[model samples]
Target: MRNKSIKKLNNKMNSKKVIVTFLILVCTIFNIGAQNITPDSKVLYKKVNGDSLYLHLFKPEISKKPTAAIVFFFGGGWVGGNPKQFYQQSKYFASRGILAISAEYRVKNTHGTSPFECVEDGKSAIRWVRENAKELNIDPNKIVASGGSAGGHVALTTALIKGLENVDENLSVSSVPNAVVAYNPVSDTTLKGYGSKKVVGRETEISPTDQVKKDMPPMLIFHGTKDKTVPFENAERFTRLMKEAGNDCELVAVDNMGHGFFNGDFFRKGTGNKYFNLTAYKTDVFLEKLCYLKEKPTLAENIKQVSCIGDSNTEATYPKFLQEKLGENYQVKNFGKGGATLIEGTNHPYFKKKEYKNSLKFTPDIVLIMFGTNDANVKWCLDKTRKTKFIGTPQEEFKSQYIKLINTYKRKNENAEIYVLTPLPIYEHAKSRDPEIKKRIKHLYDWVIPIIREIAEEQNVKLIDVNKLMKKAYKYTVDGIHLNQKGYKILAKKIAKEIK
Candidate 1:
């Protein structure tokens, strides 16, 4: 069950990245094609370690560069794992204006005297980043190492362990990271750790927390409540020891979550797990604390205040955008119901049926609407041909039902502005939908735009032409329908621009 939850979290995180990145990459490619480049850029830096170890670096293109850097190591039990495990880490940090490097280390199978080789590689990557801090426009003093599972062990060890004499022959640089951010790291090198004896040779010398020093860097650890693989108590014990030794350390145990909570089901495909993706939430907290940035996020405080209303697009839209844009100003309420249409009345199957009840209660200053996407689908009866038989026709009835929903908002808060957004284009070759369906989605602009315009005119509210905005930022969409990071960013900017 724990594994299932972690897998779910991994998938959840992956789904977010795939959607966001596709949108951003699409826009980036189009921009580059047009000699227009975005502020975000990534480059692959290869360092020779007998063979080349590829390090993927994500950085903003802005002139005043990052004040910190995060070097991430991946986990696959030390024998088989890739750098991509930190996909969300790289993107999350980069989105926050931190230079994030996802470093690939030599796995045990192909290259290494022991897991220590992985540590050496991790250390070298950190040193390389610091050595090139000036060129990379990073602050060397702010470099940190972060990872999960075996990767976490590597991060913690590289930070706490004093010498790398075994792998020193392979590198000419320091093996220390300024700070350590470990997610469920193996602090004790006993038989209890997954394959600990095989890697570290049954020695107490390998335990990281057991060797704390006054010079030890500040550390943050995130673990899950039900994490059986690396028991939550292990992390607690490690944190306790760190504090006992007068070293700076903190531990967060996510409620009802399990090991590898950084990712949700999106990463693991269809693994049927429900882990909370604690990494996604905790990572933001980690970085905020690391930089000593004043706007520290408190989950207990924010969860109660923020709500969101969206569709699948909401996953990419409100949560991904508004959370970052507004920061801590307004609590986000997510009402984004996937595959929901306005016309279904109280019995509407998806989120609409449940969300419509509280719509009046929230009485938010600004109500964001991105309802047209799923409504454009044949399933929701918004398709130009063959609308869902139960939901009525696509264009007119759909528009009327949406208007009625909006009117309720006006009744509740006369001063609140309803932002109407047009649906983004669909992918040209989506397997889920038939060719006709795909074509209908691609032509969403033809039908939905006019209806949205009419609604905006009649209501006297703002209309964010996301479809038009997204058209200019095309590369971010996978098949011209689902958005990637670039697309979400464009939409986010449009929404943020209208607000203040």
Candidate 2:
């Protein structure tokens, strides 16, 4: 009776442990956020313990030469997680002209294995990719391993640990990845860190901190400072050890975020790209440094990209005619926010919008900037309650910001040709009854345009005096503020001459 009671007590304890593990692992994977992205193709990589494992490939449309590839492993505490967890990231890498893969690895609940097998499966997946590099049209030497949480541990073990090899496979092809990109990965797996109980006797053998050595592949890690599952200290320790051994390792500690903070959240769609897009951008920067992939899509050599930065005028007008005028040689992209200002303190600043980020991304060979018309919106520059003492003048901020905006573009691409255009003259604006435009129109004429000219001369950027060119063209404007098709065509001709 005593023996039976002891077994019953142990069984209850195991049941509760399973429940806790399930909750934590479920949050790590964030299965609900996984997108239904279909890979370009799926291939059977290996079979183990009567289960066949496959790889999800996100390949570019064309692979003329053997390009670099990145492989991703999903996190589930070595327990439960979907192969689709990294689909969003995989698709993005594919779009960037590289081969990307998300692998299926053994897990505790599904494969009836320990955490060690998860590491083994990660190695096997990389080995298979290397072995079939020619078939996949990827450079075998430049493979990158990436993952989050437990999957990150798996990825790191493939590069750090060597003993967990499958017996049947040929041992010649190296399984270690050329580089690593981890998102909140479990860097340590010993008694002092996470999953130590799961690994049991072989903790140090697979712990990345223990395996750090000289001349290892470069590593880039992103970890949330507030993560409890995988303590943030583990990341710090692993990086320190890596550098001590003369290896290159960088750790990006995300502030005040918890576990699974790197997962792609579909709900964060617009300007508030909390984590997903921001992390992806950082990931690309890391990969670009390692030569794994280019950060942006490759354009044909003959085509130069143009980024048009401005207000409602650039959005609704001249860009249409500018594209036609630039002809087949240039690809023009309009990044104009309707009510945006040069001054960031205003309610609608272009610097705070997604359009600004997108503008810098297209690899612009030429940048045309036009503002000042919208800075004339007197209300945007005001403090919440102007009834109180005046904070400062908008003109004071505009001069600095205009120079700052020009310098921003120059910093983005040193070789990029930048042009600063003056705002078109407002002869009579019927749609805009703003007291400033109707009354002192001098706000734009006297205060705004002169600042624009000063910015161009001070910054050494080329100047296009659009306000001077469109002086008497009021008949071609829709509301004397916005241009019609004919007005824009005339305006495009003037800008096109400067570009040529």
In model 1, what lDDT does residue 477 have?
63
RMSD of each: 14.4, 13.7
C-alpha lDDT of all candidate models, in order: 0.62, 0.76
lDDT of 2: 0.76
What lDDT score goes with residue 447 in model 1?
A: 70
In order of appearance, the predictions have TM-scores of 0.52, 0.54
lDDT of 2 by residue, 368-472 (tens): 999888777667554454332224577767777778777777786687899989998886566755656653366787788888888888888899999988887
Model 1 ranges off by over 4 Å: 1-49, 165-173, 200-202, 264-266, 270-278, 292-500
RMSD of 2: 13.7
